[model samples]
Target: MTLPAVPPISFQDIATELRLLPGEGLSFSWDNVKRLLGMSRLHPGPISLSDFLGKTRPWWGLVPVRSNDIVGTTWYSWNQSDGGLAAAVDPYFGNMPITAIMSTVSASGSDSIINFQSDPGFRNNIKAQLLDDNYNVVREVVLTYNAQAGVQWRSATLGGGDTSTCLFIATGIFTINLIKL
Candidate 1:
């Protein structure tokens, strides 16, 4: 079946509405969490499958440091609980439609791991996926990342054609629910 097209929205825009703390504490307001998940009211924390079906928010997101720059590779890895991940993509295509599933993982004094998984077929030759809280595919991109051994910022590629352009965010034991609807 063909899906309707809806433009992508930024997490910051959603975060601003939800009043989420920025790089500080981990307290998320109940009401904002509901809105972030696109729920009418807040359900139990760590939303369940029932909640997932009712929501429309992206399943995953990556917090942009500056307007154009995404955070960092280390942050994108599942090792850092506080770190984040944007959907992987090919740079050749300016924009590709997607629905994503995402999660963050970090233990005390440990690296963060941001896991993202999705099919490239849905978006038509897309490279990677972005996720929402319920592990849903929210965004797709045509970009890839190349991380040197000790680099801070990752060099993003335009497409998934180059193996050297790809980087994997280590999948640590970050708890996330990614369900393709």
Candidate 2:
């Protein structure tokens, strides 16, 4: 089955560019959390998943922030009992696409690994997996996001080919850095 072109990893929203804290903190914020929360209220009634995901605001605003970090997913749950802060990321990205082009001959050998960028405490069992165009899980490799050694490596091989592209999805709030390897 052909999936719709996965909407460009939404990075903008309806919020005016004028700084919410105008004249200060002048930086492009990546805040999908705040944008998705108000989905139902904005669209109302029934809507297709694609339609909802496709909604583009004049611009999106930041989710609640704390100590200078974007916080909480619109759907997942977490906790910060002291100040009661919680965060989750889009599950859609969990199923983000990967392609053969994401492979490097180095990671293809037994001694090398795929590099998945991560911080020390945020990830557990972080990984990289190969998928076919149909989204079937073809192969998976558990990544060790070792910040101490500055290494984020996972071992997985999808043989060799180049006629098509698949996904090299990571296990967290994925950043878009599609490149041929």
Candidate 3:
């Protein structure tokens, strides 16, 4: 959605407003008050999802989740408590639209086993990659929605027993209902 055009407010305008005396009274409107307090500056305006995701750093806003749904659920491997496979089993997460991208680097040279995670409930495209120390992609796989198997987590073992630090990245959109499974 397009945001309404708001006239740029200058520092001089703010200074004049601050300088107003009690007898003179304040001329600022509610919108002006919001602008002066930097509330309006917090939003960068509406942006397309594709463009938003493409950015190195994207701005996002949180919306209230369904009361029945679990809050703060994430799909990260390191999050052993409430994340990773645990989040996948939450009934509320089923059929929930999820767009996530994450990466991690192997800590040790002997780290041949890299654990990857994705929303098992995803119904769209998912991409997983293994990259070498030089940022060169060693193994890459893109999984599309499948009716038979569906999208599941995948793992890649580095060949040649080579164990230089490697980066693993996964990006996907998942929307599956656990009740159906």
Candidate 4:
């Protein structure tokens, strides 16, 4: 005899494995949310006024823009036209954490490559770092903004172990994107 068909599991049910509920927001104190996404809570940063404030909420969005469309301490507009980053504001000032639903694997994972970006002509020394759930430094790299260099992005690789058991956190100025390839 054939067995009956199975219904697809709901998002809430799936969250249970991560110890989450249907309406739970990710936190720097939890694992499930961090595991599912590479979101990390940033420390408070300094407050400043700049043109970056007008930027949209999502890093990659382009429509119906509003200042309140804000996403945390960072002014990340969902839309983006330049590759500088999704958020234009200096996240360091807010001392806030950058959070995202990160990707992962059970074992034998590739390296975690982080990319940093900035204006081509600004002279600055940016301190950037990547961390794991235990708050361990996985990798660290600095991005120098020298209009001459036009080095919009500086990338460094870290961690090749199984990601199934840890959460990776990205911190610093510019945009912090974690990727494994």
lDDT scores of the candidates, listed in order? 0.33, 0.28, 0.30, 0.30
Model 3 residue 90 distance off true place after TM-score fit, in angstroms: 14
Candidate maximizing lDDT: 1
Q: Arrange candidates by lDDT, highest first: which order?
A: 1, 4, 3, 2
* The 10-residue segment with the lowest total lDDT in model 1: 104-113
lDDT of 3: 0.30
Over 89-167, each residue of candidate 4 has an lDDT whose tens digit, in order, gives 3223231222221222222332221123333233344443345443334544443333443533232222454332222
As a TM-score, model 4 comes out at: 0.24
Which stretches in model 4 have alpha-carbon errors above 4 Å?
1-88, 91-122, 149-181
Number of colliding residue pairs in each model: 42, 14, 5, 34
lDDT of model 2 at position 89:
24
> What is the lDDT, from 0 to 100, of the residue 74 in candidate 4?
17
lDDT of 3 by residue, 1-181 (tens): 1121343534334434333344554433333333323224333444222221111111111111111112422222222232332232222234233333222233222121112244444454434344333223355444344444343332232334333321222232221111121
User: Per-residue lDDT of 91-139 in model 1, one digit per residue for the tens?
Assistant: 2222232222222222222111222233233322224444445434344
- On residues 62-176, what C-alpha lDDT tens digit does candidate 2 reach at each position? 1121221123211111112222211222222232211111323322222123232232233344343343332233544454434554534333334343212222322322222
